[model samples]
Target chain A: MKRFLVVGSRDLTEYVNGKYVPLVVEELRAKGHDVTLFLIENGVIAARDGSKAGKVLNGLSDKGARVYAEDVSCRARGVQTLASGISFSNLDFLADSIAEGFDNIVWY
Target chain B: MGKTEPPGSKKKKTQKVAIILSTGSYQREAPTTVLRLAEKLLERDIEVNVFAFEEAVTLTNRDQIEHNEPPSLRKVLGDRHVYVGKFVDQLLRVGLHGAKMDWVTCVLCAQERGVENHQIGGSIVGTLGDLWKFVRGADHVIAIPTYR
Candidate 1:
């Protein structure tokens, strides 16, 4: 199975790019690829407990795709509690993922 | 005695600056800042090249202006060098046109946006390779991301 990492930079419901990420991840996973969703910048909202995007991301996580929020981004935005299933990560992970040869890296 | 520099030893070099703008027209803030910067650079005799992409391409649509005013791109960019990526066909009412401005749109971006033969007169259809030529030849490149 191909490995995929999708990076987002805006709240999932705030822009077209944000809203499209989960859909793209689901599609890739449905096609039998392993997918990981990483939210950064304002996109950290996707991991907030009560946000609309957070719920959607939780559903995607339950379906098998892994979801994460950048730790620095969350701290800056005061996002203390992440939505269920979303984990905190860092840029180091992103660099390592690239080095580990992810088949596809999508940034939005 | 301290070291004495020779006369005419260090001639002033003309700075070549390039700006890539990705915000659309309506936002106003980012584009205004870009034009102001370009104007400031021109005042200091710096060579400026501007490339507009995504929604920023709307700046080339002359008819979309709400009203004419100072600091507006049309007023400020007069006789200046400007370019827009062709993917703009999706949002533009018309393409760049004017006697004083030099404007070109990326051909591939335009075709991808289904803008074949549809842009207003005066804008040249170019390619990304051409854009890269400017970027590579320039001394400094500035990118203004989309804000809205």
Candidate 2:
């Protein structure tokens, strides 16, 4: 399995319901790769608790996929109540993932 | 360092790409990567589907655009039939879809952008079901978000 840093977006309504954020994360883990999902902008909401995605988000953690959220994005978007594995980080984390050899495949 | 295949050794690889943007005209690095990736897949004859949602719907709007480098907007959208209504038909025309997905949040986005009644053609904008369908079979999905 290839190293993937899947990207999520900010729109959680209409086209972007919460279920998919974890669906992608779960698939990556099922494939047996070291995976981590980065929530940027709207993606940050996936990290929140008590949502349908929180179950999947925590499942990703169980399967060893680290969930990361952008701190700046969180603050900018005014997101609170993050999920278990979801935590804040920097946008440079994305760059670092790339430098560490994660081919990015984002979902917004 | 691993057993990675050389440049164009891929023929039947599966890919799922979701692109979210504020507007189709925001020619940033994300779109650049996405457009280039779509082009590469088409060139390699690998299966590629770019789920365009939010402002990404603008990706198919080939009118009055300006990001034409190796990623020619006219060519990229034209090649994948990103022009909207014909996206799937065009993919089939090029013999490139085992499964192609459309993730357009056209209504929500349209309203946000005051386009709730925008009659732009070349695309179909509808429901979350479509987004889930795309996510279901996606090998990999990416989002380029639009602030709207």
Candidate 3:
């Protein structure tokens, strides 16, 4: 089981709507791989309450994949409250994850 | 003490690097970045393989275009190391015909799209399975997907 860190720098409208990165996350998880979704930039909006893409993210979170939103990105956009099951993260944490040797790092 | 070995006794292993470029030429930094990375890798004696998918097919057939001081992608990727997706390349061809790399358009993709013309030189018909094999066999694989 390879470890994967998926970085999302785009918003949900451009990302989940196109069904590329989200589908990749779902498919990788289905294949029994360890996957983490790291949302940055406008991607933080995807994990907020009552968002169209947040619903999909929530489902993915329940399906055994961890979801995180970057702290600064959320704050810059005035997003203080994240949806249930979503957590805050930063690039340092991402760097540490890479230093710990994740098999693959995919940025979308 | 270490034993002295003869020159050329150990064969150097070539690292296979595969890159998937899905963006079109001049769309953004990705198109040029892929070529730059490939050039750097090639300079280090690494084996570079590029798979151009989606709108990136325009890059394979596009003539010399200079934008914002970027090097010519066609000259950088060279002739034999690049591969263009057949379906998109054929659909978007402007008859410029300067591609020097290999073209592997899947038969199924062509048939599904009702594409019958395969007139471009340095082109071939292949399958998704072949591309998968190329990627899986590489030591490193980097995919620069479309921004849209």
Compare the candidates by TM-score and give the number of the best one: 1
Model 3 collision count: 1
Q: Candidate 2's residue-wise lDDT over B65-144, tens digit each?
A: 23334545656455332233234235434543433333354567656655444434434566666666766765545455
Candidate 1 ranges with C-alpha deviation above 4 Å: B1-127, B130-148
**Best-to-worst DockQ order:** 2, 3, 1
In angstroms, give how far residue B48 of model 2 lies from its true place.
21
> Can you write out model 1's per-residue Cα lDDT over A23-102, one digit (the tens) per residue?
99889889988888878777787788998878899988988988888777788789988888788876555444543435
RMSD in order of candidates:
15.2, 12.2, 13.0
Model 3, span A44-107: residue lDDT tens:
8888877777888888888777788877678778878777667787655553454343567686
Q: Which stretches of candidate 3 lie over 4 Å from their true place?
A: A15-17, B1-148
User: What lDDT does model 1 reach?
Assistant: 0.61
State the DockQ of every prediction: 0.02, 0.09, 0.04
For model 3 chain B, where is the 10-residue window of minimal lDDT? B1-10
In terms of DockQ, which candidate is strongest?
2
- The predicted structure with the larger lDDT, 2 or 3, is 3
Model 3 per-residue lDDT tens digits across residues B23-98: 7645754555455445444444455556656665555443323333234654765434333333334422422342
